[model samples]
Target: MTTMEPQGGFSYSEADFRRVQDIARREAGINLPISKRSLVFSRVSRRIRATGRASFRDYLDYVSGREGQDELKELICVLTTNVTQFFREKSHFEHLEAHVLPQLGEKLRAGGRGRLWSAACSTGQEPWSMAMSVMAELPDALRMDLKILATDINHAVVETGRIGQYPAEEVRSVPQRWQDAYMEPMEMEQVSMAREIRRLVTFRPLNLNREWPFKGQFDVIFCRNVVIYFDDETRNALWKRLADRLVPGGFLYVGHSERVDCIRECHLEAVAPTIYMKKG
Candidate 1:
Protein backbone atom coordinates (compact mmCIF):
# COMPACT_ATOMS: atom_id res chain seq x y z
CA MET A 1 0.00 0.00 0.00
CA THR A 2 1.18 3.51 -0.73
CA THR A 3 1.77 5.69 2.28
CA MET A 4 1.81 9.48 2.72
CA GLU A 5 3.25 12.04 5.12
CA PRO A 6 2.04 15.22 6.85
CA GLN A 7 3.23 18.81 6.49
CA GLY A 8 2.84 22.17 8.34
CA GLY A 9 3.15 20.31 11.65
CA PHE A 10 0.11 18.45 10.34
CA SER A 11 0.67 16.10 7.45
CA TYR A 12 -2.07 16.37 4.78
CA SER A 13 -1.60 13.49 2.43
CA GLU A 14 -2.56 13.97 -1.21
CA ALA A 15 -5.15 11.18 -1.10
CA ASP A 16 -6.76 12.62 2.02
CA PHE A 17 -7.26 15.91 0.26
CA ARG A 18 -8.83 14.17 -2.73
CA ARG A 19 -11.24 12.22 -0.55
CA VAL A 20 -12.49 15.28 1.31
CA GLN A 21 -12.89 17.19 -1.94
CA ASP A 22 -14.97 14.33 -3.33
CA ILE A 23 -17.09 14.37 -0.18
CA ALA A 24 -17.88 18.07 -0.66
CA ARG A 25 -18.69 17.62 -4.35
CA ARG A 26 -20.91 14.61 -3.74
CA GLU A 27 -22.74 16.07 -0.77
CA ALA A 28 -23.19 19.71 -1.78
CA GLY A 29 -22.06 19.83 -5.40
CA ILE A 30 -19.31 22.13 -4.21
CA ASN A 31 -16.30 21.18 -6.27
CA LEU A 32 -13.17 21.75 -4.23
CA PRO A 33 -10.59 21.39 -6.96
CA ILE A 34 -6.91 22.17 -6.35
CA SER A 35 -7.55 25.89 -6.21
CA LYS A 36 -9.90 25.42 -3.24
CA ARG A 37 -7.56 23.15 -1.32
CA SER A 38 -6.63 25.96 0.97
CA LEU A 39 -10.29 26.71 1.69
CA VAL A 40 -10.84 23.06 2.53
CA PHE A 41 -7.88 23.05 4.88
CA SER A 42 -9.02 26.25 6.47
CA ARG A 43 -12.40 24.70 7.28
CA VAL A 44 -11.50 21.11 8.18
CA SER A 45 -7.86 21.01 9.24
CA ARG A 46 -8.49 22.40 12.71
CA ARG A 47 -10.77 19.49 13.47
CA ILE A 48 -8.24 17.03 12.13
CA ARG A 49 -5.61 18.59 14.33
CA ALA A 50 -7.98 18.46 17.28
CA THR A 51 -8.56 14.75 16.84
CA GLY A 52 -4.79 14.20 17.16
CA ARG A 53 -4.93 12.00 14.13
CA ALA A 54 -1.78 13.69 12.73
CA SER A 55 -2.76 12.48 9.27
CA PHE A 56 -5.66 13.40 6.99
CA ARG A 57 -6.04 9.74 6.05
CA ASP A 58 -6.93 8.77 9.59
CA TYR A 59 -9.22 11.77 9.87
CA LEU A 60 -10.95 10.87 6.63
CA ASP A 61 -11.33 7.26 7.69
CA TYR A 62 -13.02 8.29 10.91
CA VAL A 63 -15.28 10.84 9.24
CA SER A 64 -16.37 8.59 6.34
CA GLY A 65 -17.05 5.24 8.00
CA ARG A 66 -20.67 4.29 8.58
CA GLU A 67 -20.42 4.87 12.30
CA GLY A 68 -18.68 8.14 11.55
CA GLN A 69 -21.09 9.54 9.00
CA ASP A 70 -22.65 11.80 11.59
CA GLU A 71 -19.23 13.24 12.31
CA LEU A 72 -18.73 13.78 8.59
CA LYS A 73 -22.02 15.64 8.35
CA GLU A 74 -21.11 17.82 11.31
CA LEU A 75 -17.85 18.67 9.62
CA ILE A 76 -19.65 19.61 6.42
CA CYS A 77 -21.91 21.94 8.37
CA VAL A 78 -18.97 23.64 10.01
CA LEU A 79 -17.04 23.98 6.79
CA THR A 80 -19.98 25.27 4.77
CA THR A 81 -20.80 28.98 4.80
CA ASN A 82 -24.07 30.05 6.42
CA VAL A 83 -25.00 33.70 6.59
CA THR A 84 -28.57 34.70 7.40
CA GLN A 85 -30.45 37.61 8.93
CA PHE A 86 -34.03 38.70 9.44
CA PHE A 87 -35.51 40.30 6.33
CA ARG A 88 -32.23 40.00 4.50
CA GLU A 89 -34.22 40.08 1.25
CA LYS A 90 -37.00 42.50 1.96
CA SER A 91 -38.99 42.31 -1.27
CA HIS A 92 -39.57 38.56 -0.96
CA PHE A 93 -41.08 38.99 2.49
CA GLU A 94 -43.27 41.77 1.13
CA HIS A 95 -44.33 39.58 -1.79
CA LEU A 96 -45.42 36.86 0.58
CA GLU A 97 -47.34 39.28 2.78
CA ALA A 98 -49.04 41.26 0.04
CA HIS A 99 -49.63 38.60 -2.60
CA VAL A 100 -48.95 35.02 -1.58
CA LEU A 101 -50.39 34.62 1.89
CA PRO A 102 -53.77 36.11 1.09
CA GLN A 103 -54.25 33.75 -1.85
CA LEU A 104 -52.91 30.69 -0.01
CA GLY A 105 -55.05 31.41 3.04
CA GLU A 106 -58.19 31.57 0.90
CA LYS A 107 -57.43 28.15 -0.51
CA LEU A 108 -56.68 26.72 2.95
CA ARG A 109 -59.91 28.13 4.35
CA ALA A 110 -61.72 26.37 1.54
CA GLY A 111 -60.48 23.03 2.95
CA GLY A 112 -57.10 22.91 1.25
CA ARG A 113 -53.99 22.38 3.32
CA GLY A 114 -51.40 25.12 3.25
CA ARG A 115 -47.71 25.06 4.01
CA LEU A 116 -44.61 27.07 3.08
CA TRP A 117 -41.10 25.71 2.92
CA SER A 118 -37.76 27.46 3.17
CA ALA A 119 -35.34 24.99 1.64
CA ALA A 120 -31.70 25.67 2.51
CA CYS A 121 -32.82 28.00 5.24
CA SER A 122 -29.41 28.54 6.84
CA THR A 123 -29.98 30.07 10.28
CA GLY A 124 -33.80 30.19 10.40
CA GLN A 125 -34.31 33.84 9.44
CA GLU A 126 -36.07 33.24 6.11
CA PRO A 127 -38.59 30.72 7.39
CA TRP A 128 -39.36 32.84 10.42
CA SER A 129 -39.94 35.72 8.05
CA MET A 130 -42.36 33.52 6.13
CA ALA A 131 -44.16 32.66 9.35
CA MET A 132 -44.52 36.29 10.29
CA SER A 133 -45.92 37.10 6.87
CA VAL A 134 -48.41 34.27 7.09
CA MET A 135 -49.51 35.33 10.57
CA ALA A 136 -49.79 38.93 9.54
CA GLU A 137 -52.18 38.00 6.75
CA LEU A 138 -54.32 35.68 8.81
CA PRO A 139 -56.33 36.65 11.85
CA ASP A 140 -54.87 35.37 15.15
CA ALA A 141 -57.55 32.76 15.84
CA LEU A 142 -57.46 31.37 12.31
CA ARG A 143 -53.69 30.98 12.25
CA MET A 144 -53.47 27.76 14.26
CA ASP A 145 -53.49 25.43 11.27
CA LEU A 146 -50.94 27.14 9.08
CA LYS A 147 -47.33 26.03 9.38
CA ILE A 148 -43.99 26.77 7.70
CA LEU A 149 -41.15 24.28 7.44
CA ALA A 150 -37.56 25.48 7.73
CA THR A 151 -34.73 23.13 6.81
CA ASP A 152 -30.95 23.21 6.47
CA ILE A 153 -28.09 20.74 6.34
CA ASN A 154 -26.79 21.88 9.71
CA HIS A 155 -28.31 20.15 12.72
CA ALA A 156 -26.94 22.86 14.98
CA VAL A 157 -28.82 25.54 13.05
CA VAL A 158 -32.03 23.53 13.19
CA GLU A 159 -31.76 23.35 16.96
CA THR A 160 -30.91 27.02 17.25
CA GLY A 161 -33.92 27.87 15.07
CA ARG A 162 -36.36 26.12 17.38
CA ILE A 163 -35.23 28.19 20.34
CA GLY A 164 -36.14 31.35 18.34
CA GLN A 165 -33.90 33.67 20.32
CA TYR A 166 -31.22 35.90 18.86
CA PRO A 167 -28.81 38.66 19.77
CA ALA A 168 -30.53 42.05 19.46
CA GLU A 169 -28.26 43.16 16.65
CA GLU A 170 -29.19 40.19 14.49
CA VAL A 171 -32.79 41.40 14.40
CA ARG A 172 -32.29 45.16 14.34
CA SER A 173 -33.05 45.55 10.66
CA VAL A 174 -36.47 44.00 11.03
CA PRO A 175 -39.12 46.71 10.80
CA GLN A 176 -39.87 48.25 14.17
CA ARG A 177 -43.52 47.27 13.89
CA TRP A 178 -42.60 43.67 13.19
CA GLN A 179 -40.09 43.74 16.03
CA ASP A 180 -42.73 44.96 18.43
CA ALA A 181 -45.34 42.55 17.15
CA TYR A 182 -43.29 39.39 16.75
CA MET A 183 -40.44 39.61 19.22
CA GLU A 184 -40.49 39.65 22.98
CA PRO A 185 -38.04 42.17 24.45
CA MET A 186 -36.30 40.04 26.99
CA GLU A 187 -34.96 41.16 30.35
CA MET A 188 -31.86 39.20 29.38
CA GLU A 189 -31.46 41.83 26.64
CA GLN A 190 -31.86 39.34 23.81
CA VAL A 191 -34.77 39.24 21.41
CA SER A 192 -37.10 36.24 21.64
CA MET A 193 -39.40 35.26 18.78
CA ALA A 194 -42.97 35.78 19.87
CA ARG A 195 -45.14 32.69 20.25
CA GLU A 196 -47.07 33.66 17.14
CA ILE A 197 -44.09 33.35 14.83
CA ARG A 198 -42.44 30.61 16.88
CA ARG A 199 -45.44 28.31 16.81
CA LEU A 200 -45.85 28.74 13.07
CA VAL A 201 -42.45 27.40 12.08
CA THR A 202 -41.17 23.81 12.24
CA PHE A 203 -37.39 23.58 12.13
CA ARG A 204 -35.85 20.36 10.88
CA PRO A 205 -32.44 19.10 9.82
CA LEU A 206 -32.32 18.51 6.08
CA ASN A 207 -29.58 17.70 3.65
CA LEU A 208 -30.79 19.45 0.53
CA ASN A 209 -28.18 17.63 -1.50
CA ARG A 210 -29.92 14.40 -0.53
CA GLU A 211 -33.56 13.43 -0.71
CA TRP A 212 -35.78 15.93 1.08
CA PRO A 213 -37.66 14.31 4.02
CA PHE A 214 -40.88 16.26 4.11
CA LYS A 215 -44.26 14.54 3.71
CA GLY A 216 -47.09 15.63 1.38
CA GLN A 217 -46.78 18.87 -0.57
CA PHE A 218 -46.24 22.57 -0.01
CA ASP A 219 -47.84 25.71 -1.40
CA VAL A 220 -44.56 27.56 -1.84
CA ILE A 221 -40.86 26.82 -1.66
CA PHE A 222 -38.29 29.55 -1.05
CA CYS A 223 -34.89 28.19 -2.05
CA ARG A 224 -32.89 31.36 -2.33
CA ASN A 225 -29.15 31.93 -2.58
CA VAL A 226 -28.31 28.21 -2.37
CA VAL A 227 -28.01 26.83 -5.88
CA ILE A 228 -24.80 28.71 -6.66
CA TYR A 229 -22.79 26.16 -4.72
CA PHE A 230 -24.23 23.33 -6.77
CA ASP A 231 -23.23 22.21 -10.25
CA ASP A 232 -25.62 22.39 -13.17
CA GLU A 233 -26.63 18.74 -12.97
CA THR A 234 -27.27 18.92 -9.26
CA ARG A 235 -29.20 22.18 -9.60
CA ASN A 236 -31.48 20.72 -12.26
CA ALA A 237 -31.99 17.57 -10.24
CA LEU A 238 -32.92 19.66 -7.21
CA TRP A 239 -35.36 21.65 -9.27
CA LYS A 240 -37.13 18.47 -10.28
CA ARG A 241 -36.98 17.05 -6.75
CA LEU A 242 -38.37 20.25 -5.26
CA ALA A 243 -41.14 20.32 -7.82
CA ASP A 244 -42.24 16.93 -6.58
CA ARG A 245 -43.19 18.57 -3.29
CA LEU A 246 -45.04 21.56 -4.65
CA VAL A 247 -48.65 21.81 -5.70
CA PRO A 248 -49.28 22.45 -9.37
CA GLY A 249 -49.27 26.20 -10.07
CA GLY A 250 -47.70 26.88 -6.68
CA PHE A 251 -44.88 29.37 -6.38
CA LEU A 252 -41.15 28.57 -6.35
CA TYR A 253 -38.74 31.33 -5.40
CA VAL A 254 -35.07 31.21 -6.32
CA GLY A 255 -32.23 33.55 -5.47
CA HIS A 256 -31.99 36.65 -7.63
CA SER A 257 -28.54 35.95 -8.99
CA GLU A 258 -29.22 32.26 -9.73
CA ARG A 259 -31.28 30.85 -12.57
CA VAL A 260 -31.29 28.02 -15.10
CA ASP A 261 -31.28 29.28 -18.66
CA CYS A 262 -33.47 26.43 -19.90
CA ILE A 263 -35.96 26.10 -17.06
CA ARG A 264 -38.96 26.74 -19.30
CA GLU A 265 -39.34 23.03 -19.91
CA CYS A 266 -40.06 22.51 -16.22
CA HIS A 267 -43.44 24.21 -16.68
CA LEU A 268 -42.47 27.15 -14.48
CA GLU A 269 -43.40 30.73 -15.15
CA ALA A 270 -41.52 33.89 -14.29
CA VAL A 271 -44.45 35.19 -12.32
CA ALA A 272 -44.28 38.20 -10.04
CA PRO A 273 -40.95 40.05 -9.75
CA THR A 274 -38.53 37.34 -8.60
CA ILE A 275 -40.80 34.33 -8.20
CA TYR A 276 -41.57 31.36 -10.47
CA MET A 277 -44.82 29.47 -10.43
CA LYS A 278 -45.30 25.85 -11.43
CA LYS A 279 -47.84 25.42 -14.21
CA GLY A 280 -51.00 23.44 -13.65
Candidate 2:
Protein backbone atom coordinates (compact mmCIF):
# COMPACT_ATOMS: atom_id res chain seq x y z
CA MET A 1 0.00 0.00 0.00
CA THR A 2 1.29 3.42 -0.98
CA THR A 3 1.64 5.57 2.10
CA MET A 4 0.71 9.20 1.86
CA GLU A 5 3.60 11.32 3.08
CA PRO A 6 3.17 13.05 6.43
CA GLN A 7 0.29 15.51 6.19
CA GLY A 8 0.62 16.88 9.68
CA GLY A 9 3.89 15.41 10.96
CA PHE A 10 2.51 11.83 10.60
CA SER A 11 2.30 9.45 7.70
CA TYR A 12 -1.22 8.04 7.17
CA SER A 13 -1.74 5.18 4.72
CA GLU A 14 -4.73 3.40 3.23
CA ALA A 15 -3.89 0.44 5.46
CA ASP A 16 -3.86 2.67 8.54
CA PHE A 17 -7.27 4.04 7.61
CA ARG A 18 -8.69 0.52 7.13
CA ARG A 19 -7.29 -0.48 10.49
CA VAL A 20 -9.05 2.47 12.05
CA GLN A 21 -12.31 1.52 10.39
CA ASP A 22 -12.02 -2.03 11.71
CA ILE A 23 -11.08 -0.98 15.23
CA ALA A 24 -13.96 1.49 15.40
CA ARG A 25 -16.42 -1.16 14.24
CA ARG A 26 -15.12 -3.86 16.58
CA GLU A 27 -14.75 -1.66 19.65
CA ALA A 28 -17.71 0.71 19.42
CA GLY A 29 -19.84 -0.60 16.53
CA ILE A 30 -19.12 2.57 14.55
CA ASN A 31 -18.86 2.22 10.77
CA LEU A 32 -16.43 4.57 9.07
CA PRO A 33 -16.53 4.73 5.31
CA ILE A 34 -13.91 6.07 2.94
CA SER A 35 -15.51 9.51 3.07
CA LYS A 36 -14.69 9.64 6.77
CA ARG A 37 -11.00 9.10 6.02
CA SER A 38 -10.21 12.78 6.43
CA LEU A 39 -12.30 12.98 9.58
CA VAL A 40 -10.59 9.90 11.03
CA PHE A 41 -7.23 11.43 10.27
CA SER A 42 -8.09 14.78 11.81
CA ARG A 43 -9.46 13.30 15.03
CA VAL A 44 -7.04 10.42 15.52
CA SER A 45 -4.10 12.68 14.69
CA ARG A 46 -4.54 14.46 18.00
CA ARG A 47 -4.24 11.12 19.78
CA ILE A 48 -0.95 10.51 18.03
CA ARG A 49 0.40 13.84 19.30
CA ALA A 50 -1.03 13.46 22.81
CA THR A 51 0.46 9.99 23.24
CA GLY A 52 3.83 10.96 21.75
CA ARG A 53 3.55 8.37 18.99
CA ALA A 54 5.81 9.07 15.99
CA SER A 55 3.23 8.16 13.34
CA PHE A 56 -0.34 7.00 12.77
CA ARG A 57 0.92 3.41 12.63
CA ASP A 58 2.65 3.77 15.98
CA TYR A 59 -0.42 5.25 17.66
CA LEU A 60 -2.70 2.60 16.17
CA ASP A 61 -0.42 -0.18 17.35
CA TYR A 62 -0.25 1.21 20.85
CA VAL A 63 -4.01 1.59 21.09
CA SER A 64 -4.56 -1.90 19.73
CA GLY A 65 -2.37 -3.49 22.39
CA ARG A 66 -3.57 -4.66 25.82
CA GLU A 67 -1.91 -1.69 27.52
CA GLY A 68 -4.05 0.70 25.47
CA GLN A 69 -7.47 -0.05 26.99
CA ASP A 70 -7.71 3.39 28.59
CA GLU A 71 -6.63 5.13 25.38
CA LEU A 72 -9.12 3.01 23.50
CA LYS A 73 -11.88 4.59 25.55
CA GLU A 74 -10.54 8.01 24.62
CA LEU A 75 -10.51 7.06 20.95
CA ILE A 76 -14.15 5.98 21.07
CA CYS A 77 -15.07 9.24 22.79
CA VAL A 78 -13.27 11.35 20.20
CA LEU A 79 -14.81 9.39 17.32
CA THR A 80 -18.41 9.60 18.57
CA THR A 81 -20.34 12.87 18.41
CA ASN A 82 -22.27 13.94 21.54
CA VAL A 83 -24.34 16.93 20.44
CA THR A 84 -27.58 17.15 22.44
CA GLN A 85 -29.80 19.70 24.17
CA PHE A 86 -32.89 19.98 26.33
CA PHE A 87 -36.00 18.69 24.58
CA ARG A 88 -34.18 18.18 21.32
CA GLU A 89 -36.43 16.75 18.59
CA LYS A 90 -39.34 18.53 20.21
CA SER A 91 -41.86 16.28 18.52
CA HIS A 92 -40.75 13.24 20.52
CA PHE A 93 -41.13 15.12 23.80
CA GLU A 94 -44.49 16.38 22.60
CA HIS A 95 -45.64 12.85 21.90
CA LEU A 96 -44.30 11.74 25.25
CA GLU A 97 -46.33 14.43 27.01
CA ALA A 98 -49.44 13.95 24.90
CA HIS A 99 -49.48 10.14 24.84
CA VAL A 100 -46.77 8.16 26.59
CA LEU A 101 -46.63 10.02 29.91
CA PRO A 102 -50.35 9.74 30.47
CA GLN A 103 -50.19 5.97 30.28
CA LEU A 104 -47.10 5.85 32.50
CA GLY A 105 -48.74 8.23 34.96
CA GLU A 106 -51.67 5.89 35.31
CA LYS A 107 -49.42 2.92 35.89
CA LEU A 108 -47.37 4.72 38.55
CA ARG A 109 -50.51 6.13 40.23
CA ALA A 110 -52.01 2.64 40.41
CA GLY A 111 -49.01 1.43 42.41
CA GLY A 112 -47.24 -0.09 39.40
CA ARG A 113 -43.60 0.61 38.60
CA GLY A 114 -42.39 2.78 35.69
CA ARG A 115 -39.02 3.16 34.04
CA LEU A 116 -37.72 5.48 31.35
CA TRP A 117 -34.28 5.08 29.84
CA SER A 118 -32.28 7.65 27.93
CA ALA A 119 -30.12 4.97 26.40
CA ALA A 120 -27.80 7.38 24.63
CA CYS A 121 -28.24 10.23 27.03
CA SER A 122 -25.53 12.80 26.40
CA THR A 123 -24.63 15.28 29.13
CA GLY A 124 -27.90 14.58 31.03
CA GLN A 125 -30.14 16.95 29.12
CA GLU A 126 -32.32 14.20 27.65
CA PRO A 127 -33.06 12.49 30.97
CA TRP A 128 -33.41 15.83 32.78
CA SER A 129 -35.91 16.85 30.14
CA MET A 130 -37.64 13.55 30.77
CA ALA A 131 -37.76 14.32 34.51
CA MET A 132 -39.25 17.71 33.75
CA SER A 133 -41.86 16.18 31.53
CA VAL A 134 -42.78 13.66 34.19
CA MET A 135 -43.04 16.37 36.84
CA ALA A 136 -45.27 18.48 34.64
CA GLU A 137 -47.70 15.62 34.13
CA LEU A 138 -47.31 13.91 37.47
CA PRO A 139 -46.18 16.24 40.23
CA ASP A 140 -45.98 13.37 42.69
CA ALA A 141 -43.65 11.38 40.47
CA LEU A 142 -40.81 11.66 42.99
CA ARG A 143 -43.02 9.94 45.53
CA MET A 144 -44.13 7.28 43.08
CA ASP A 145 -42.27 4.18 41.97
CA LEU A 146 -40.87 5.89 38.87
CA LYS A 147 -37.30 6.66 37.80
CA ILE A 148 -35.32 7.68 34.72
CA LEU A 149 -32.07 5.93 33.83
CA ALA A 150 -29.55 7.95 31.85
CA THR A 151 -26.51 6.22 30.42
CA ASP A 152 -23.76 6.91 27.88
CA ILE A 153 -20.50 5.41 26.67
CA ASN A 154 -18.52 8.55 27.45
CA HIS A 155 -17.50 8.70 31.10
CA ALA A 156 -16.98 12.46 31.06
CA VAL A 157 -20.47 13.19 29.76
CA VAL A 158 -22.02 10.75 32.24
CA GLU A 159 -20.26 12.65 35.03
CA THR A 160 -21.65 15.90 33.63
CA GLY A 161 -25.16 14.44 33.73
CA ARG A 162 -24.59 13.12 37.26
CA ILE A 163 -23.55 16.61 38.37
CA GLY A 164 -26.80 18.09 36.94
CA GLN A 165 -25.19 21.43 36.04
CA TYR A 166 -25.19 23.14 32.67
CA PRO A 167 -24.35 26.49 31.14
CA ALA A 168 -27.17 28.98 31.70
CA GLU A 169 -27.62 29.38 27.97
CA GLU A 170 -28.13 25.67 27.54
CA VAL A 171 -30.91 25.55 30.14
CA ARG A 172 -32.65 28.38 28.31
CA SER A 173 -34.02 25.84 25.84
CA VAL A 174 -36.03 24.28 28.65
CA PRO A 175 -39.55 25.68 28.92
CA GLN A 176 -39.71 28.67 31.22
CA ARG A 177 -42.35 27.10 33.44
CA TRP A 178 -40.29 23.99 34.04
CA GLN A 179 -37.14 26.10 34.27
CA ASP A 180 -38.51 28.17 37.11
CA ALA A 181 -39.76 25.08 38.90
CA TYR A 182 -36.67 22.94 38.47
CA MET A 183 -33.63 25.08 37.86
CA GLU A 184 -31.45 26.93 40.34
CA PRO A 185 -29.12 29.75 39.43
CA MET A 186 -25.45 29.35 40.18
CA GLU A 187 -22.41 31.58 39.95
CA MET A 188 -20.33 31.58 36.74
CA GLU A 189 -23.37 31.76 34.47
CA GLN A 190 -24.34 28.18 35.20
CA VAL A 191 -27.55 26.55 36.28
CA SER A 192 -28.14 23.49 38.40
CA MET A 193 -31.14 21.20 38.21
CA ALA A 194 -33.10 21.31 41.44
CA ARG A 195 -32.74 18.38 43.77
CA GLU A 196 -36.30 17.44 42.98
CA ILE A 197 -35.45 16.91 39.34
CA ARG A 198 -31.98 15.49 40.03
CA ARG A 199 -33.38 12.92 42.41
CA LEU A 200 -35.59 11.48 39.65
CA VAL A 201 -32.71 10.56 37.36
CA THR A 202 -29.74 8.19 37.66
CA PHE A 203 -26.71 8.66 35.39
CA ARG A 204 -24.22 5.91 34.67
CA PRO A 205 -21.77 4.78 31.97
CA LEU A 206 -23.21 2.26 29.48
CA ASN A 207 -22.21 1.03 26.06
CA LEU A 208 -25.09 -0.10 23.89
CA ASN A 209 -22.78 -2.47 22.06
CA ARG A 210 -22.23 -4.53 25.18
CA GLU A 211 -24.54 -6.63 27.31
CA TRP A 212 -26.72 -4.60 29.64
CA PRO A 213 -26.23 -5.10 33.40
CA PHE A 214 -29.87 -4.63 34.41
CA LYS A 215 -32.54 -7.15 33.49
CA GLY A 216 -35.70 -5.08 33.77
CA GLN A 217 -37.57 -3.55 30.82
CA PHE A 218 -38.57 0.05 30.22
CA ASP A 219 -41.84 1.86 29.64
CA VAL A 220 -40.29 4.39 27.28
CA ILE A 221 -36.81 4.69 25.78
CA PHE A 222 -35.17 7.60 24.00
CA CYS A 223 -32.35 6.21 21.84
CA ARG A 224 -32.21 8.83 19.15
CA ASN A 225 -29.41 9.81 16.78
CA VAL A 226 -26.76 7.37 17.99
CA VAL A 227 -27.35 4.36 15.76
CA ILE A 228 -26.40 6.23 12.61
CA TYR A 229 -22.79 5.48 13.45
CA PHE A 230 -23.38 1.75 13.30
CA ASP A 231 -23.46 -0.50 10.26
CA ASP A 232 -26.57 -2.34 9.13
CA GLU A 233 -25.94 -5.56 11.04
CA THR A 234 -25.04 -3.88 14.29
CA ARG A 235 -27.86 -1.36 13.93
CA ASN A 236 -30.45 -4.05 13.32
CA ALA A 237 -29.19 -6.12 16.22
CA LEU A 238 -29.32 -3.09 18.49
CA TRP A 239 -32.88 -2.36 17.41
CA LYS A 240 -33.91 -5.90 18.29
CA ARG A 241 -32.15 -5.71 21.63
CA LEU A 242 -33.84 -2.42 22.45
CA ALA A 243 -37.18 -3.82 21.43
CA ASP A 244 -36.66 -6.83 23.67
CA ARG A 245 -36.09 -4.43 26.55
CA LEU A 246 -39.44 -2.65 26.02
CA VAL A 247 -42.56 -3.74 27.82
CA PRO A 248 -45.66 -4.34 25.76
CA GLY A 249 -47.24 -1.01 24.77
CA GLY A 250 -43.94 0.74 25.55
CA PHE A 251 -42.48 3.27 23.15
CA LEU A 252 -39.17 3.56 21.31
CA TYR A 253 -38.07 6.96 20.00
CA VAL A 254 -35.30 7.23 17.43
CA GLY A 255 -33.72 9.92 15.30
CA HIS A 256 -35.73 11.43 12.45
CA SER A 257 -33.35 10.02 9.88
CA GLU A 258 -33.49 6.46 11.24
CA ARG A 259 -36.13 3.78 10.79
CA VAL A 260 -36.75 0.54 12.63
CA ASP A 261 -36.21 -1.91 9.80
CA CYS A 262 -37.02 -4.97 11.89
CA ILE A 263 -40.33 -3.76 13.21
CA ARG A 264 -42.30 -6.90 12.37
CA GLU A 265 -39.59 -9.21 13.66
CA CYS A 266 -39.27 -7.17 16.82
CA HIS A 267 -43.07 -7.03 17.32
CA LEU A 268 -43.05 -3.25 17.02
CA GLU A 269 -45.30 -1.11 14.91
CA ALA A 270 -44.83 2.45 13.76
CA VAL A 271 -47.05 4.84 15.69
CA ALA A 272 -45.63 8.11 14.40
CA PRO A 273 -42.64 9.52 12.67
CA THR A 274 -39.57 8.14 14.46
CA ILE A 275 -41.77 6.49 17.07
CA TYR A 276 -42.59 2.80 17.44
CA MET A 277 -44.71 0.97 20.00
CA LYS A 278 -44.14 -2.53 21.24
CA LYS A 279 -47.30 -4.43 20.44
CA GLY A 280 -49.08 -6.42 23.13
Candidate 2's TM-score reads 0.95
| CA-only RMSD, every prediction | 2.8, 1.4
TM-score of each: 0.90, 0.95
Candidate 2, lDDT over the whole model:
0.91
For residues 1-280, write the lDDT of model 2, one tens digit per residue. Answer: 9775457777889999999989889988988888888888889999888888888888888999999889988888878888999999999999999999888989988999999999999888999998999999989998999999999998889999999999999888887888899999999999999987888899988999998999999999999999999989999999999999999999999999999999999999999999999999
What Cα-based lDDT does every candidate model obtain? 0.77, 0.91
Candidate 2 wrongly placed segments (more than 4 Å): none
Instruction: Give the least accurate 10-residue stretch of model 2, judged by summed lDDT.
Output: 2-11
* Best prediction by lDDT: 2
* True-vs-predicted CA distance for residue 187, candidate 2, Å: 1.5
**True-structure Cα RMSD, model 1:** 2.8
